[model samples]
Target: MNAQTLSVPAAIRARRTVRHYRPDPVPAELLDELLDLATQAPSAWNMQDRSIVVVSSETGRKALSEAAFGQPQPLEAPVVLVFVAETAAWEAANTDISAQATGSGAWNEQFTAMFESRAEFHSLRDRGLIRENAVKNAMIAATYVMLAATSLGLASAPMNGWDPELVKQAIGIADRDDLAITVMVTIGYTDAPPPHPGRRPRERTVHTELYAG
Candidate 1:
């Protein structure tokens, strides 16, 4: 099926966790397109902190499966996407952001100086906050990938039950202190679709104006 034929609502509704997948490999061109769309997802200060590693080789898949506590999805799917967050992205992005702002005639010298000062202070004094924000940014991109894959008639399963340290080692990034393994998403064609367990109603989840409860 063509991705252009699917509406956003249809894609969202059709998406399901696919634990079993066919042996066919996802085409490289399609994968690249999907990733490009996934990158369109928003990030704080346009930092674009998410980094993805595509694992398709049998050896790499085997290692990732072990890291994921022997989950078969990693081995069964033709491609496993590992999303990592660069916690230092904000620091690296600050200069370019200021440059772009200036180039676009949106730059405020005083504001830019204050923002950089605050960002540096947080990086040095509030490391935990920076890491948390980076993880959130990465997850947002992962969600986009899942939805885009679904629109392209591919199956996907997002897994979080893996040991972070093991995953880093499996992906050969164990020594990268600036990066955090955020999540893993397995994507491919699936013969069996997981049952839709359904979602909670808005009344129970959404709150209007203020929290009534």
Candidate 2:
């Protein structure tokens, strides 16, 4: 990673969907730091159910590349992060979060009791809400990792082309039904600088109160 880091805004602008990467490896310490920053992303109810499996080994990257329909990014980048959303983890995390929140005076007994109903709120017959919650939390964390990489002068690519079942097998968690592979991000060094970008007019895309049709 380059020591000349960018400011937050600069990093936001610097991040690119890099497909080509150099073979230079990301240090273990730096990778750990990035992962730590990723977990700092906000979670619903502070339950913090987001997770990532670091796919660093060559064999793992090979599997991930195949899972991504033979995409070269996973194979080219030195590190690939597998973002997993555990739909069932939200209910399991409630107890720990509730207890901690109450202990910290952020929640009282009555408030904590109300929080338990969140399970019922998400437990529709179709389980759609549960999956939605999980994916939202996981994506936020993945975004953090992407920006953090750019801030450190590293390159990253957020990939959505992977087959979920194949990804699960790549991570050795195929038997688990509650987990969903929301996204994967490849992080490494890149020689190519990001190209200039074009954005829609703010008036057209950014509505004030309600959406503009």
Candidate 3:
């Protein structure tokens, strides 16, 4: 089905955390489109410090499954997308944040010069904050992928049950100190629909005005 046919609300309601998938392989072009859609998710200062590893080969999938402590979803699905956050993206100073802002006409030369100082402050004084920001932005992109996949008539499962060190080694990014493994997503078609565990009511989770503790 085309994206125009599936409304965002419909896709959100229909999405399920699929655990089992048919052996059918996802098309390369379709996966590319999905990835493109995912990158559209907003990031801090438009740094977009996220990277994805697409594991479609049997060997890669097996390695990822092993790293994930034998979780069968990675093995069962035709494609496993691994999201990573490059924590050191801010180190680039002008390239990561300033260039995007200037190119998009969102900032002028004066603002670009101003942002460089702010970026330096974060890199030097708020390293931990930068890392946290990267992980948060990456997770948002991963969520976008799941919803976009559902819209395109595919099933997805967002997995967090995995060894980060082993996952990095399995995906051959263990040497990169700046990259943090965020989440793994299994994508493919599912025949048996899993039962939906209903969500909690809004009042139970959302707090109005001042959070009444």
Candidate 4:
């Protein structure tokens, strides 16, 4: 329940990317729970503007593999979750609240009127602070999902090596600009041993007083 009480070290050690799976399906309930756990991640102003597209079908996996530079692991894993950072949702919420307080029901319409287009909506993404928060929120949510999967005895890999626009288009989402792909996570059991070789020694990665002090 509390950060201090969490046994994260054990979870960190157990969590790994398993490329080989036994073709077993992840239970729907467990998948739902894992997604719920991911939302527990903190977001800017509690916006929580993140969405997930679960790709479980063979066709979906094939498309994802293509989007991910033809990586075969997406096809091997039972599930591939595409984490999306929804900037439009946050923009719409802020616009609605501002309009309600100012007694204007047609807020976005008014914005379109002034800009002579839908340019104002795109302005929301131009703001560096909002963009930064959007990315941070999405990444934190993905971390939660990975940790939850580990706790559930499932292996996962957080991926960012993909074409965002292509992946968004492949997923068939209408609002392409609004939702930006942040990461992908493959979930399943592993046949190979955990690849613990890549990790840095604890002493090298951690510090006590100060680095080079």
Q: What stretches of model 2 exceed 4 Å from their correct place? A: 1-4, 119-127
In order of appearance, the predictions have TM-scores of 0.88, 0.90, 0.91, 0.75
Expressed as tens digits, the lDDT of each residue in 40-152 for candidate 3 is 99987667889899999999999999998999999999999999998887667546467767889998998788667665546643555767788898999999999999888
Q: Is candidate 1 or candidate 4 better by lDDT?
A: 1
Q: Model 4: which ten-residue window has the lowest total lDDT?
A: 112-121
Candidate 2 lDDT over 1-213, as tens digits, reads 456878889988778889999999998878888998998898877767778999989999999999999999999999999999877775553687888899999988877876776755466315657777878899999999999998987889999998999999999999999889999999999998668576777787888899876
The lDDT of model 3 is 0.86
**Residues 1-213, model 1: lDDT tens digits:** 363646689989999999889999999888998889888898766667788999999998988999989999999999999999988776653687778776787757886776566565376436557887888889999999999999888899999999999999989989999999999999999887888999998898889999976
Off by over 4 Å in 4: 1-7, 94-127, 207-213
State in Å the error of residue 150, model 1: 0.8
| Model 4 quality (TM-score) | 0.75
- Count of clashes, each model: 0, 0, 0, 0
| TM-score of structure candidate 3 | 0.91
> Residue 62 error for model 4, in Å?
0.7
